[model samples]
Target: MVRKTLISNKAFGFLFLFIFLLLPSFISAQTQEYKDYTVEKGDTLWDISQKELNDYFLWPKIWKENPEIKNPDRIYPKQKIRIPLYLLQKEIPETKPKPELETKPEIVKEKPVEKIIEPVKKEYLVNKDILIAIGYIADSVHSVGKITDSPVDRTILGKDDYAYIKTDNPVKIGEKFYIIRSVEKVIHPESGRKLGYLIEILGIAEVVNQENDDVKTIITDSYDEIPTGSLLDNFYEIEPPLAFENPRKPDINGYIVATRQLHIINGTWDIVYIDKGKKDGLQVGDILAPTLQSKHKIINGLIQLINLRESTSTAIVRKCNNSITKGDGITSVK
Candidate 1:
């Protein structure tokens, strides 16, 4: 009896040791696996979760893992996302077999259902406001000229009218140019540096003939009077209208530098130029809030970016509670 008891005790000790040794491997095997997924254009967090994890509601799980994603609705292409192994290995449950029917019932007539079609809404990046904004920016000209002569000494030139301009630079016949008048000098609000001269486009003209220092041009289009000492620059083409995408706000803050309207106060649908642009990571359709600085920050309006340049951008006011004007601070939309 003593020998049997000893053998039993030895077996129990060996069993406990085996379980202790295999416990770590079992826990390690139960741990979740991870995989990386590269984001593509037009991909959204919800869509990605649905496609990769087979669960669209798990988008928050993805966002939790990637704290860099500040906005779940505004993710850019080429971003990397981590996916879990359980989702990838999930299996569909098998359907149970249906019981056989006992007997066939009488046939019944069914009503036809009506199909309803919904109209698709079209989205646009460039609208009338955007075009006006572009025109305002294009009004600034570098090359200059002066009206030398016109038929009957006409001070104002219109469409289909011929005017002779004197410029120091050579003019190529058949080239088109814009006739503009200097309006004001734009200076950087912060640095006090002279940015450039803002001008008003008076008319468009095509060079019909070129003399030694005189270029005869026929006005093709005119918005205002084209008089003597009017500046000239190469014609600028307006970019084609584009559709607006889901835009992400820029990380930097700026302020309104100029407005297309001549008035001091601006409201809804007005085009305004901001000091930030592509260099600041601003994109078309990105919305910004305009705030007035006094004792405290007062939000006055919302503006959506429609056109972008190197150091500046054009935005159209979408909504306004108070009048917006130059010097108002602008920041990324929250």
Candidate 2:
């Protein structure tokens, strides 16, 4: 009798184990799923976003989802596409008993593995006048000192009694100056003239010595404002409303890849290096159009917050960093 009773109890335990394992799966009732799509010729990103996402402006999201598309404008015929679907589920009550508290697991963030590849380097084609203007603004806003002019051409305001600002010059006395070293692409909202990213300030030099006409060394750093050539001026304001008025036009794109913060090169006042070079189809003298990252929301959807999303900053490929790798900023409108 004792043996028979023991066998029956063992059978009950097995049945309970099987039921417990299958219960959660049956209660959740989730299954894998997918949607099929047929590609049509001349289907631009704008077209697909309008059809799939219901918002024509959401083309960026579609392109981001499908990096395989390559260019936003290019698509082929009869290409098979898979649309991702995020399932909706209601939160269920916890049923499992709480176990004894244990030590937390160590959080280790794995760095992305980047392949070692040679980057293409090309000479920049910056305009001398534009660089001058950019440099002027950079100094005035970010650096300390004033740019002054004399028969000597330019000089930084100095403590020397002989030195004085030529008011006739574009840069006035007590005005600050900055050197425009390089340009990088920034993003604007595709719909309007707005910034889509943080405004970046890279390299710069200060107006130092102002008096000597024969030898003018714009102080790379100084506490006093002096009339000098190191003092540069911004011919125009670097704002979206003051700049791009149209959305359809192709904008310059890229990000600051490297910088010479030390002000080593004579011309490298606030100089910034861009990822885009000649190989990815960019010239050195190219100027960047910037856009600030914007926020978004889903008006009416079950899982809008969780499913649909917006991005802060994305690189525009004004200059190709080569190998089409990460950290290479892309093109944008100025």
Give per-model CA RMSD. 19.7, 19.4
Best by TM-score: 1
Error of 1 at 313 (Å): 2.2
Clashes of each: 0, 58
- Relative to the true structure, candidate 2 reaches a TM of 0.24
Model 1 steric clash pairs: none
lDDT by residue (154-222, candidate 2, tens digit) is 443333322332223434333333332223233322333322222232223333344443213233333
TM-score list, all predictions: 0.53, 0.24
Query: Candidates' lDDT values, in order?
Result: 0.69, 0.36
Which stretches of model 2 miss by more than 4 angstroms?
1-34, 87-334
lDDT of 1 by residue, 1-334 (tens): 9999999999999999999999998887666466778999867665797788875445666766776765554577888877766566667565797898789889989898898987643334543323532344432467656677786688767778999887656778887887777667767666776655655667788889876666788988766656766778667776634444345556568878876552111212366777887887777778788888656878786787777777787776656677787788897666
